[model samples]
Target: MANIGIVIPAAGQGKRMGAGYNKQFLMLMEKPILAHTVRLFEESDFVSEIVIVGAEGDISVIKELVYYQEFHKVAAVCIGGVLRQDSVRAGVRALSPTIQRIVVHDGARPLLTLQAFHKFLEESREYSAAIMGVPIKDTVKRVDIAGKVLDTLPRDYLRAVQTPQIFDREILEEAHQQAASAGYYGTDDASLLEWMGHPVQMVEGMQENIKVTTPEDLLLAERILTQRR
Candidate 1:
């Protein structure tokens, strides 16, 4: 088994979800969204430890969930910083020294499967970094600030990125440190490496790996769960 460490960033305010709380705490079927996400790693053969990063006030709640849910893979509950990248940095800092590889996943994306996890881990062995994403199917347009369509982007070359981005521990740490020193925050972990001139591979991601960002997304997740059952 690989000495892989997973960092789940769940500290978002989730104002768009209109849940008045962290979306990770929102129920998907009978389980919280965070629980569902964590369960995937718990059931994964490649994951060795998990560090959940959340708001300070919610740290206890996450710890309680880990205990009651019997998620033995959970090694720590970290208090997140203001930004998503900052929270990810905190989680990275909390990883055990034995961790050779790091995977950063979104807590709201609970549709990830064990197969995806395995695939990402396997790719990590060959590449310094790899991320899961699907090719963009919609016609993409480059619009200006005034909302005028500038040009049609080549959809064939575009990808809609998702989480469980895998990275070697050294590369991830260097990326994070460089980002902090440069005061630069990328859209995701892979972007950080990209900014550092690192090459990252994109693996095929499941279409169902949707992120629960809005109420409609939550409903869709519920329907997906129902259909799976």
Candidate 2:
């Protein structure tokens, strides 16, 4: 069995959510969104450690949550940076040195299933990098900066990527290091690997495995939880 460490970047202000605070601190069911996400990994059999990277101001709250919840797998709570990528980088550095695999996941995504987690981890052993994504069901259009439609993107060739993206610990660390040296910024953790020419595989992700970013998303997340119950 591989020793896996999960890095959760939860420092975003989520200005779009209009919550006036960190959206991860918002309530999902009876618990905060961040707590729900942490509980998932905390219960995973394959995960050996979890490092949560959040804004410095929220570190105390995160620590209190972990302490009160008795999240034994939570090994560290590191301060985050301005960008999401920066937070992930900090989390990677904060993980236990023994961890062989790294998983980067959004702290607001609470609907990820154990099946997806297990499948990604199993498949990652064969591939250096793997992530969960869903094929686009709706037609997508490529537009210019002025909002002029340039071309219609084939949905077949497109995928809406989600987390948790898994990667070999060394590979991810190297990718981040190279990206930093080159002054490159990737939209997601896997994009950094892609920039390094790493072959990344995708695992089919559930549509319900959505990031809680907006008020509408929160409502849907509640409905999903209710349906599950």
Candidate 3:
């Protein structure tokens, strides 16, 4: 139960965020976004250790934050690659050999409340692989490059997938290896498993579980954080 290891991929440059630096370093309610993300798992009873994958330039920054915050669960801080997939793989490799389960989450998404996190963890225990996703509440559409409506996608089967994707260590490692060997770059970790013919269960996620990609997203996160507080 305490063998669960969490990998946080914080290597994204956040070019769209226009922060002129890694957005995860940006403060949210007086703490770094990445710090907020890690603290959730650190406080959880299920997680035993953590591995953070960051850019080469941000390694010291991340290490400093972990030390200052007294995040004793941090096992390693590894250099990440250009792609998110590569960063996740690096983090997975940093986990201890005894860790039988892995949870990969985005460092920018700091608003994931402990209640939701533990709920997902509890409900996902019966599955080999599980991910959090929210049902698409809005009307959907499929459009072409010319802005022409091709077809209206069914919202009933659509979901906006969020992170903290949980997987068995052995299967996740194998999925990464297969993807690397085949030169397949997937949109997310679940997609990699999907490509490898693995069934991934989708548990209901919160609407506020959004990844901060732009400045607007940061503002929205702030509001949600305040509300949560």
* Model 3 per-residue lDDT tens digits across residues 91-130: 9999999999999999999989889999999989999899
| lDDT (tens digit, per residue) of candidate 2 on 1-229 | 4578999999998999998889999988989999889998998888899999999999999999999989999999999988998999999999988998899999999999887788767766788899989999999999999999999998888999999898888999999999999999999989998999988898888899999988999999999999999
Prediction 2 TM-score vs. true = 0.97
- Which prediction has the highest lDDT against the true structure? 3
lDDT value for model 3: 0.94
Q: RMSD to native for every prediction?
A: 1.0, 0.9, 0.9
lDDT of 1 at 31: 89
TM-score of 3: 0.98
Q: How many residue pairs clash in each candidate?
A: 0, 0, 0
Mind giving the per-residue lDDT tens digits that candidate 1 earns over 4-42?
899999999899999888989999999899999999999
Global lDDT of each candidate: 0.92, 0.91, 0.94
| Predicted structure 1, TM vs. truth | 0.98
Task: Pick the winner on lDDT between candidates 2 and 3.
Answer: 3
